[model samples]
Target: MKVFNEIETAKLLPMRELMEALRVAAQDCVEGKIVSPERMVVALKEGGIMLSMPATADDIAIHKLVNVNPRNSKEGLPTIHGQVVAMDALSGVMLFQVDGPTVTGRRTAAVSMLGISRLLAHQPKSVLIIGVGKQALNHVEAIAEIFPDAAIHMRGRSAHGAQMFVDQMKSVAPNLRVEEAGVDHDVVIAVTTARSPVYSELAKPGRLVIGVGAFTPEMCEIAPAIVDASTVYVDDPLGATHEAGDLIQANIDWSRVKSLASAFSEQPDFSRPIVFKTVGTGAWDLAACRVIKARL
Candidate 1:
């Protein structure tokens, strides 16, 4: 099998291309074209969990193994570590191996953008990103490409982490204003693992709020008020009911939450603010592999 490390995967899958692939995959998922099984999660003895996600889309098949360790930050390591193995559907031959964390970080951000893309009549003027982790960096890069003129704001629990993210952003985008996160923003993407709601209030309408973190029922990053104010959408209805902490803890009615496929298929009401929540899916990994293989 061809081993495409994190660096290679990053180089092959550009934001624009990856987002486009996700768009197609989202539609396929909505159309019931992709087969992605429920992720099997095993609890680790050291206060973390490991996930095995297997999926197939057309001729591409992928199995993504990921782990979440809350104690990793103390060890100067990433809180999450993952890898993806790509295989051929017809022959069941392993084709390539890539960094799971990188694919996931980029794919998750791109999926968020795909949802945001359908909701936008125009480009957002500003975006607020919660947490200065890898996911935040991916979103910043993707947003810079999609909404070039929009300002980027990053919020972290630690001032040092936030400042470092701001400095890094400034080096690549000097003219692009990177500031501390606040309520006065056009789009809000929360990627934190906070137990309490991260955003209590949104100051404006036409705002897009994305919750990519807080996957488990124990972690809650979105407030009940935010869910009440916005029209909620999820990547998958069934998965959301089980894994989406923001919606589950809030007791959100599954019937009320629209799927991403339905949102793209029909003309959704944009009168209220939009809250797009994703727990991440293997179909995206399969789609990402398709893009990666084509580029190579």
Candidate 2:
């Protein structure tokens, strides 16, 4: 069995490769070539912590156990932390252990990008990202790799954090314009754990919005206005209904929401203001594990 730390995992799975793998995985899922059960969750306390268990299998099986503590901010620690275990499907032998948080951030960003690839028309010229945490950083890196020409706008709850992210990102993409904009962009990605809505307005007529925060009904990153203004799509029907705050808080008709699997499989009109909300799924982790194992 192999053990991969956070740094090692980052070195192994670059943003570009991860995004490509996730795109394939998403297609496989839409085509019913993979089996990914809905993620299971256990609340640790009232408004405190929780554990999410997600599993996925295709040629091999893997499970990711993630711990989420919203109160970790008081301790000056990350709110999300965990590890992933990959095992042989036929033999049931554990194969690898990788940093769960790293995988989560990478896979989540890649998954959002995968949805973007499927739903958007032309590649975006700029992307506005809300939040400056690990997931936000990963989103910037992934978007930069996938859409190199796109400018990046980062917004954080704290001005200091947003500026810091901008400074660090400029070193990586010197030619890439990084700014703190209000809401002008071709693509908008909300990755904060904000309990309230962070963005209310939709982008341009044909823009795309990807919401990665609010894995639970209690938290929401994008506001209700955005949900109302855009056509919505979800990775999983049950996952989105139970985990996404954007949909839950909006009081939008559940019947109007479309599943990505169905949309991709049936071929839907991609020329519209679209909102893709993902609570993250075990199937994605499984897909990522398959890629990692193959590379290994």
Candidate 3:
């Protein structure tokens, strides 16, 4: 069986193509052409979590195992690490194993961009990303790819870390701008693990808010008021209700919730602010697997 490490996987999964693949998968999931079991998570010490997500569609089967260690950054290690395994559904034969973190970082950012592409009426002129984690950096990369002309801004909890992040980003894109976290940006992406709201005044009208962190009920990154005010969309309805703290805490009307799949069919009203929250999904993992395999 073939094995691709983290670097190889990251190299294989290009952002634009991966985002499109996820868009296709999202449509398939809504059409009932795919089957993905709910992810299973186990609590670990020091506020960490380990999860297993498995899914099957057509002739392909895939599983992703991930670990989240909140304290890893203190030890100079990445907070997330994992692996993705692919198999032939009919023959039950193992096909390959790829680095989980690479697939996840790329796909998760792609998922958020997918939301932006489908829901937003226009390309953003300015973008604000709150948080400097792996996801945040990847989100910047994806945003840069999708909206090449947009000015990029970043904010993190620690001022020093935020500066460091900005410096690193400048090394890559010298013209990128760094700004304080605020409410007026055309696109706002919150990727922090803050238990409380990151920016309380994020209820600005017509802006696109992508909440990528705060997956559990105990963690709330986006303010409740923003969630309640916006026309909300999620990657998965059931997963959002159970796992998205921003949605659960806001007590959003589930009947009004729209899936990304529907965006593929028709565009929703973009006059009001749109909030897209995802708790991640196995179907996305499967979609990413297809991208990696095809590239190989």
Candidate 4:
């Protein structure tokens, strides 16, 4: 089987195309054209996890194996590593593989971008991103690529951390800056692994909030008020039930939460506050796989 390195994998998953691919996959998942079961998680030593996610559709299939080791950060090592293998759905032959972390970073950001495009009424003028991890880097890159005109802001737990992140990202995003004065922005994305809420403001109109960092119930990035006050949406309704910590912690009505697919079919009341929480699933990986497969 052909194997692509991290750089090659990233080259294949361009932001615009990856976002569009995720757009199609969102609906396919709703239509039952793609079948992706809940991911399998196994414990690893020192607060690590092995995640196995598989999805299949009529045209193609993919399996993503990811290892997340939080302790690695202290060792100056990458926190996540893995591979995504594209395969023939009928014959089950692995055609090619891409770096796992690359797939996860690009596809996760694509999902958020799709939400931003569908949920908001107007193009974003300014965006505030919380956290400065690999996920944050992907979101910044995706935003620069797709929303070049929009001003990008970053905020970490500490001022120093935020400044460091801004400095590190200067090469890719010269316009990126550390957020100051805590002003209102067009869109707010919280991608941290914080146990407590990182964004606590109450919901307001025209502000699209996306929570991407918190996956488990114990991890929450948005406060309960924000979730309860907004017309909430999730990229994967099935995965959100158990993985979306922001909504789960709020104890809101599940019936009120809409799917990303619903937004494509119908227009939402943009006058109301919006929140799009995504836990992610294998269907998105399959979408990324399909994108690269066609290009090759």
Candidate 5:
């Protein structure tokens, strides 16, 4: 199998390309054209978790094995690492391998971008990203590439942490600033793993809020009042019911939550606030592989 390195994997899955692929995959998932089951997660001794995600579609099949080790941060190492393997669905032949963390980070960011493209009534002029982790960096890069003109702002627990994140992202989002502007950001994305709420401000019209982190029910990024004030949409309808920490903690009605496919098929009431929660699925990974495989 042809093995692609981290940089190579990134080159294969460009922001706009992967975002479009995710769009198609989202529709396919809704139509039952793709088969992606709930991921199998195993806990490790060090409070880490090993995740196995598999998906099969008419065009491609993929499996992602990723280990998330939060304790690695103390050793100055990446928190997540793994690889994604692609295969011919019919022949069952391994075709190629790509870096798992790359696919996860980029695809997760692309999901947010897709949400922005489909949910927002207009282009986001200003965006506030909460958290200084890898997900935040991926989002900054994705937004810069897809919406080059949009002003990017980042927020962290501390000012130093936020500035350091901006310094690291200078190459991608040079003008990225610490979010202290008086004007309201058009989009607010919370990518933190905070158990308590990180963004509690009430959701308002003309603003889109996206929750990227907080997978388990014990974790949350947005406050309950925000989820209550906004029309909630999740990237994976099935996954959200179980993994969407913010929504689950808020005790929102599942039937009221809409899917991303509905965002494309049905028109939303833009006059009201909107919240997009994403607890990723393997279908997105399968779509990401298709983007890279097509180039090969």
Candidate 6:
């Protein structure tokens, strides 16, 4: 069986490649070419911690298991951690094990970028990133690579954390401006698990917003105003409706929002502000793993 570490997996999964793979996966999802069970979740505390299991399969028919937790920072550990086990489609033999933490970070950002590519009007000139963690840093790297001319604005709960994120990213893209300020940008990406809203009034009309945070009903990072002001898109209707607090708390009619599958199927008008929310799915993990394996 093949085993992959974080750095090895990172090298195998680049943002542009992952985004292309996810685009194909999204089309398959819309055409009913994939089977993805609704993600299963278990709450650990009243509303503080939770565990999730999401799985998927492809032409090779190997199924992958991804275990994820969104509350581990307090213990000085990664908030998301787990392993991906690839199994034979017929005999169900374990074929390989890959680091889920690395897969999750890469795929999550790829999925968001996939949505952005399909739904947004034009490439963004600047990006506003909320929360300064692994996801945030990975997102900056991914978005910067995709949109080389765009500047990145990072914000975190602590000034030091925000500054650290800026410094680390500056090393990679020295010409890129990394600041700790709240300003409207062409794109806004939120990846925190904050229970309360983080940036409510920062969204401007005609901007693209991506919410990768708050996979549970009680957690939300983007403000309700953002939801109310933008046209909403979701990766999975059932998953986002049940887990995305930004949509749940806004009390928006679910019928008004379009799923990524349907959005690509119908080719809707995206002339106004838009919001894309994802609770993360197993199909994405499988899609990413398949792409990484092929590259290796």
TM-scores of the models, in the order given:
0.95, 0.90, 0.96, 0.98, 0.98, 0.90
lDDT of 2 by residue, 113-189 (tens): 77777788878877878888878878887877787787888778777777888888886654344455464577888
lDDT against the true structure, each candidate: 0.83, 0.78, 0.85, 0.91, 0.92, 0.75
Give the backbone clash total of model 3. 0
Which of the numbered candidates is closest to the native, going by highest lDDT? 5
How well is each residue in 1-296 modelled by candidate 1, as lDDT tens digits? Answer: 98977899888788888988888887887777889988898999687999999998777889999999888888899988888999998898999999988999998988888877886546777788888887888888888877778888877887677888888887654434445534367788899888899877752468888899888888888898888778888986767888999988888877789988787678777777888899988988888998998987
After superposing candidate 6, which stretches have Cα over 4 Å from the reference?
Answer: 45-54, 61-71, 175-183, 265-268
Better of 4 and 6 by lDDT: 4
Per-residue lDDT tens digits for candidate 5, residues 1-296, read 99999999999998888988999999999889999999888998687889999999987899999998878888999989999999999998999999999999999999999999989999999999999999998999999988888988889999999999998888878768888858689899998888899998878998999999888788899999999999999999888888899999999999899999899989988999999999999999999999999888
Q: Give the Å error, residue 85, model 4.
A: 0.8
The window of 10 residues in a row where model 4 has the poorest summed lDDT is 174-183
Error of 4 at 183 (Å): 2.3
Ranking by lDDT: 5, 4, 3, 1, 2, 6
Model 5 stretches astray by more than 4 angstroms: none
Query: 2 or 5, which is superior by lDDT?
Result: 5
Clashes of 6: 0
RMSD of each: 1.7, 2.3, 1.5, 1.0, 1.0, 2.4
Any runs in candidate 2 off by more than 4 Å, and if so which?
30-33, 175-183, 262-271
- The ten-residue window of minimal lDDT in model 3 covers 174-183
Displacement of residue 288 (Cα, Å) in model 2 is 0.7
Worst 10 residues of 5 by lDDT: 174-183
Root-mean-square deviation of candidate 4:
1.0
Between candidates 2 and 3, which one is better according to TM-score? 3
Which clashing pairs does model 2 show?
A: none
Over the stretch 152-264, how does candidate 6's per-residue lDDT look in tens digits?
78778877788787887887755345554555587788888888888676555668888888788888877888888788999877678788888998887898998877766
Error of 6 at 88 (Å): 2.7
